[model samples]
Target chain A: MAGVAAEYFLEAIVIKPIRLRGKIKNGIAEVKALLPHPMETGARVDSEGALVPAHYIEEVVCQRNGEMVLRAEWGASVSKDPYFSFKLHNSTVGDKITISWTDNLGDTATGDITLA
Target chain B: MHRRALVKGLATLLSLGLLPLNLYARAVAAFTAEQAADVYRELFGSAAILPSDRIHIKAPEIAENGAVVPITVSTDLANTQSISVVIDENPNPLSGTFYLTEDSAPEFSLRVKMGRSSTIRALVRTADGVYMSGRQVKVTIGGCGG
Candidate 1:
């Protein structure tokens, strides 16, 4: 084949961990999370005055029991140690909740919660 | 040939139809969009966003530090498909966008950075149309720019 001998490229993946916290109160399931990330803006200088590369979470996805609830597209403008809070209506206790995110550099993590 | 087998194996998946949904969530261009107007353009495509009382944006009137500013956005509009936030002074003003489903309310709380004093615009996309609201935030110190 013409392209049979073409070089193959391998992709590497990195998995991070996410911490989740939330509680259901008054029939509303309020969920929030703190994502520990550097959230570099790519425009900042290091202590040595060298430009720091941009590294930040680009997307956040939340779901309830395998169904999508909230999906977010984020940029580098998010502050360091990004955190978010969202509410779920029509959801009851013991429903499984999942939160996940992928960064600009492709680092990803998933966090899980069960309503209490 | 090895290449032929590789190509054939890749196409053998029967679940190809669900691929679009996976790709839709990874739109990097919209996240990197520099201007708020460009972001809205990509969503509405020349359609005007109406000023609405249904959308609400809550943010501190003055931020002591630009690194982290707390903001909350909620909307009363029904059937909201998405909610987005834009900071007028940031280099990439389109801070983020949220796509919601029936299980969740059209409200979220997040922290973002501000380069300077700016207007925080929150928009909601519903079946009826696009509606938005804006709140001013004064920054005593500018956030580090990228």
Candidate 2:
């Protein structure tokens, strides 16, 4: 068996808020976020005989124009790609929604979507 | 030559015996208590969580597959701030966490992945300073040897 460190490539990836239809009905603003992460559990080994360290996104926060709206804390139980959906109150068509997250490895990702 | 053949046969049996042992070892490596506590602290800041009836967590008693589990958390508290779901025996205890604002209602739902049979806990923090929690859900494997 290979070492864990050499088993896989670790990259920090972020998604800029992509607008999706059906998120808003009437006045409530619904937002969905998809973050790219490997969520490694630090248990697996690579072909290079290295032990892969556990790396996963630990915190997620969603804000509407500097106002804290939603927040989440996750662990390795989350899947490879983490997706979150939330609803914002009294949001109009021009409000900005910001979603940010920090991984266990200190990697951070942020995405923003404009309410329409 | 006969002695050598006997030794080889014994070696083969020993190897076969080791195979099942290895499989069992992997199965038991799914989750640990220390890992669960780590996840709990990361989410709640401490393991001394007080269980409250204000939060109601809905989940299937026995999950057919360990891969996908559907969980719903609802609270009667006004101005609920956040809701979190945790699996006590999963490799990673923290499953899903949701932060709710005054604009949103007090109920939220989501799907989480489970690596094996474990206890799921939901914690709810209201707009006030008090913290409340719900009960544990027992998840079981259906067909997937989870």
Candidate 3:
């Protein structure tokens, strides 16, 4: 119950936001996703020269038609507000694609699109 | 009705293990050079990380926004298995690791958050267990705390 409350709050605040789009062409689907994040490396100093704590996306999962297409492990090296694109073959016009990301802080967000 | 079916389908997918549980788990907060080397060891086994010009890293010499720096890694190497990116100056050096299938092209593009000016390194592993890398990308931070 304790963990459940925090989980709900994290989802409610939406620290990770994603924008996803997909299109089908020649039996393949091209997907593009934009994710906004701080991706803090915990090395930078604040105005007072205090080191910021580490915060970055840890993993990104992409699913096509309910099947896992890609899983990415990301560290602090990825730039903030990351963008990604990939292709899926043998996909139809109406196949569903979902992209989800989890950060080091355990916050998560998801975006999905149906191929057109 | 459609929403119900989608929910059920997601449940099925979860049961089938189509989703990676690690995505929901917390990740390492920071990765030092030693830890980055360990990650390489775990992935490449005894494969030596050799420097090669085959892998190409395309990034701006100066990033307008440290929060979202665009990068591309492309290679002409055959039988490529995977590619990984590293940032030399970031608190955590290892940024991304991509596994490419035979059908997948040996190229990838993505945006990452950087803390400051840094060198971007792209490493590619071929199917023959040989590890090759591209040149460093000098990223000048225009934003962030830098």
Candidate 4:
């Protein structure tokens, strides 16, 4: 378990923290991340029957050893508490993997992991 | 015509001394688009996706809860540039698109919401061309309404 447990956030603090886990095997590094978000679609009404405003992750970027590996653009249809995973090739034991996401509300969370 | 109008509007603002630095950021047209093909065309610059067996989508045949249908997409296509997921019947059919580099593997997993039983598609944009594969998912309960 090479999970360094790195979580970073700026002002406009989000409610929950982001999680990242990673490991390298057979020249490949596998990474999994959980970004806690409401993921509101702007269509659902509250218990009071008022439409909930849309708030979801707009983009996510991943880096390997300070090099850009992946960048993703998302819409509101992604499920709540979004779970994402991806892999990297030609990986080494000490490779650092960084994941960050920005939401529609302009909130962001970044975390990193050192693969073992 | 639209570009000309936008230029004219900018000129009018400039003439009125109302020009501001970076007035408005270019909006991502595909992010809010409702149609799947249009979204694809807007984002990847192509909607004529050809069917391919290389793209593999792993998902449930029947999703008990439409709010969270888990899926994983992977492909062996060489020079893979990007992979994206599309739900045919969602209000906004495009769920997400992952742009990858040479260091990144051609595998992506994410959860998505479905308004109803719909076709889930995995599209691959490679150096050669755009390819796609899809699977049908039946939702017992709708989740997008919420």
Best by DockQ: 1
Tally clashing residue pairs in candidate 1: 1
| CAPRI tier for the interface of model 2 | incorrect
lDDT of 2 by residue, A16-98 (tens): 44333326678888676667666666664555557767777777777777777776666566655665555666878877788
Per-model TM-score on C-alpha atoms: 0.84, 0.64, 0.72, 0.83
Question: Chain A of candidate 2 scores what in TM-score?
Answer: 0.78
lDDT of 3 by residue, A1-75 (tens): 321222223423335458888777888777888888777766556565456666778788777777776677787
Name the 10 consecutive residues with the lowest summed lDDT in model 4 chain A: A1-10
DockQ of each candidate, alpha-carbon based:
0.48, 0.18, 0.30, 0.40
**Model 2: per-residue Cα lDDT at residue B60:** 79
DockQ of candidate 2 relative to the true structure: 0.18
Q: Which regions of candidate 4 are displaced past 4 Å?
A: A1-14, B1-27
lDDT of 3 by residue, B1-146 (tens): 45346657766787899966533332233344435566566556677888777778888887767777888888888877767887765555677876665544566689866667777778787866555564444445544454
Stretches of model 3 off by over 4 angstroms after superposition: A1-13, A48-50, B1-30, B34-39, B50-54, B64-67, B76-79, B101-104, B114-118, B142-146
Model 2 whole-model lDDT (C-alpha atoms): 0.61
Task: Give the Cα error of residue A81 in candidate 2, in Å.
Answer: 0.9
Residue pairs clashing, model 2: A2-A47, A2-A48, A2-A49, A3-A48, A3-A49, A3-A50, A4-A50, A4-A51
Q: Could you give me the TM-score of model 4 versus the true structure?
A: 0.83
Q: What is the interface RMSD of each candidate, in Å?
A: 4.8, 10.6, 5.5, 6.0
How much of the true contact map at the interface does candidate 2 reproduce, as a fraction?
0.41
